[model samples]
Target: MGRRRRRKPKWVPERAIVGELDRRGRAVVAAGEDGRPREAHVDGALPGESIEYLRCDREGPVDAARTLEVLEPAPDRVAARCPHYGVCGGCSLMHMDPDAQVAFKQATLLADFASHGVEPERVLPALRGPTWRYRRRARLGAKLVPGKGKVVVGFREKDRRFIADLSTCEILAGPAQGPLADDPGRLISALSELIGSLSIAARTPQIEVSAGDRELALVLRVLDPPSAEDLDRLRAFAAQYELRIFLQPKGLDTVAPLETGRELLHYGLPDFEVELGFRPTDFVQINAPLNRAMIARVVELLELEADHRVLDLFCGLGNFSLALARRAAQVVGVEGDAALVERAQANAAANAMTNLSFEQRDLYKEPGAFEWPGGPFDRVLLDPPRSGAAGIVEHFEAIAAPRVVYVACSPETLARDAATLCSRHGYRLAAAGVMDMFPHTAHVESIALFER
Candidate 1:
């Protein structure tokens, strides 16, 4: 017995392996029957081209064996036009099929309040407009590269520092007037030639291209002071492009027109014959068509009347205030920024809207004490930022506006404030709905009508 004969393990043939070689765990990443990751599995499958299936890592109470449930069609839903749609992380629901987007947003509003045991009389239809290239304002990021002999400008990659090497953005309505989405590098090169560094900012990640009813005012964010040659280059480019340029040397306080003539960026509410004069960096809605729809929705919700006195809080450039003034007897717009108030006043005057007046008062700090032109409004419209009007929720009760229209960009904040309105302020959640302002994005823009 030669050291108690040891037994060797037999080798299993590769052919005996189970499943395809590319199959990894629960997901089979092999090319689909056609190609591309399978139409994002409407069920548990992940829509990706990798051979590995990642484990569910989402926190909270997600069922381990949960599967996705597809809903019915919505009229507003459509196939997202941008190729950079999913990866850019800017838009979320692009693939959801149009009308579905509206349904989802509507459902989001309903779900927000169902937990709070509140319901509105109606969940209105989602407000919609052109689905692609509708953004009128965009703030594209810029970076200079030494070896590339130029710079790069566009939105940052989804949740990352790097920029998406995109050529065209169909969502930007004014893309045609500027460099095509695929060619942002051209804009970067132009700016690099004109200045040491350059950046662009607009309400949307896309810049407004057309000098439509409004002039094309571009805010060129600078990292350092431009040299004289740089200024001349920029001036010439602006002249050739027929665009107005503003320089941001420091914080927003330092923003000013590089070349000031009588030219103005004046967007219009064509339906109302209202011409709104806005400088670059003003908080105008990026989608002109959607803005018109939102205004119409607000007016419809407010049931504005000649005798109605409305208070628009956080009113930027009097978008809602002027619209309210057209119908209401008096409209008081309050804002935290003095510069915006001045612009709002100018816009009101330019439109010749007699009943609206704007005031500069911080709602979060000096919410109630500041003297406003009109008081005791019959209705109040609140368009606070993502933080919601937490500091002023209580003031709503004291003011006793018969109706309140809260336009919110965040649903969690809307729900929180809605709770306050119903629970603490003795107001009823009358109606709530979502607007497709930023479609394909997780950002939810909501409008909730409250009655006291």
Candidate 2:
């Protein structure tokens, strides 16, 4: 008997689809012969704007597609500033007007709240700042593509595993006065060959970029020890660009500065009169102006007094804790990471803030699993991650704080926690609004106030 022949996978051809944008800015439509609904999140398409799209692939019921042509452009649609807008995945909503972008974010937040059967009594004005050149921190991908004969350094390609060849990054804050400002790509191209010489270049994934008001630092994540020549080249590159270079052979603990007796990187909170020193790997907000704005807003909402005691949960580097300390009689910060807790304490001490104290504890643990100190305070502040503070909210009654301010990065999780607080804990949603921490991206950072 002849051997059975193997069947080849069928080729799926791209087809035109018309769709309208939903709340999340994705185009929702029914395409193909079956007429099933599919969500195509094309970057440039906006709500009420009809567009032609080419279906790329399907994930369950949704068909991922790219905008082939905008048959009818939205009134808010504008030209994107970045030359690499479509190819680079860094900024998704650049084509939309700035005002429209914020409106979309507000609408999306409201939709998220509605989904969870919660709504704020008042929607605060959206907090916004500089739209371009606002990013002070970024993790850039680096790869030495031998076939291309050069290194590609930038963000990843749109929906692809490969890195985008970026000639310039409009959103990234460039050097004040140097060639780097004119051609930021030179930073990677100059070091491409040197990085290729290293044995771990294949495994080295990324170079972390951290920029302060005064200095820019690059942390190279290396998988293996560098040769003597490699070190020399790195030092030379640092000296030439006036940048502080750090080498990381393993984890965050392994990151070290190449030059001896170098000053640490810091950003100033001029309004609060606080200066925060942090390592390259430390977690700091990417946008400086917006962070300062957010902090001021938090202080205003807390209505802190000299006799009031406050609690700050998930406090990192004392960004909000130190500021709260200035207004409140005393502030206690709690964090899960020991390193961040230590840093927060050091920052408080450096600022001569005797009213502030920090402790390291797993905040997500069960209510009685871990002991919380210096709580049952007058006011409480929680700046949780994207996962939200479910663990803390589960035990909110134990703290019994009258007013609670939640700074959240995810609306879905925030809505979930809001539902828990309002429905279960008898707290009312006073006000909520979105902060434009990352412009041109779908990321939403927001703050909400709750009171009983």
Q: For this target, which candidate reaches the highest TM-score against the unseen true structure?
A: 2
Model 2 residue 98 CA deviation (Å) reads 1.3
lDDT score of model 1? 0.64
- TM-score per model over all chains: 0.76, 0.91
Q: What local lDDT score does residue 428 receive in model 2, on the 0 to 100 scale?
A: 95
Off by over 4 Å in 1: 1-80, 146-150, 175-212, 366-373
Give me candidate 1's TM-score against the actual structure: 0.76
Could you tell me which residue pairs clash in candidate 2?
A: none
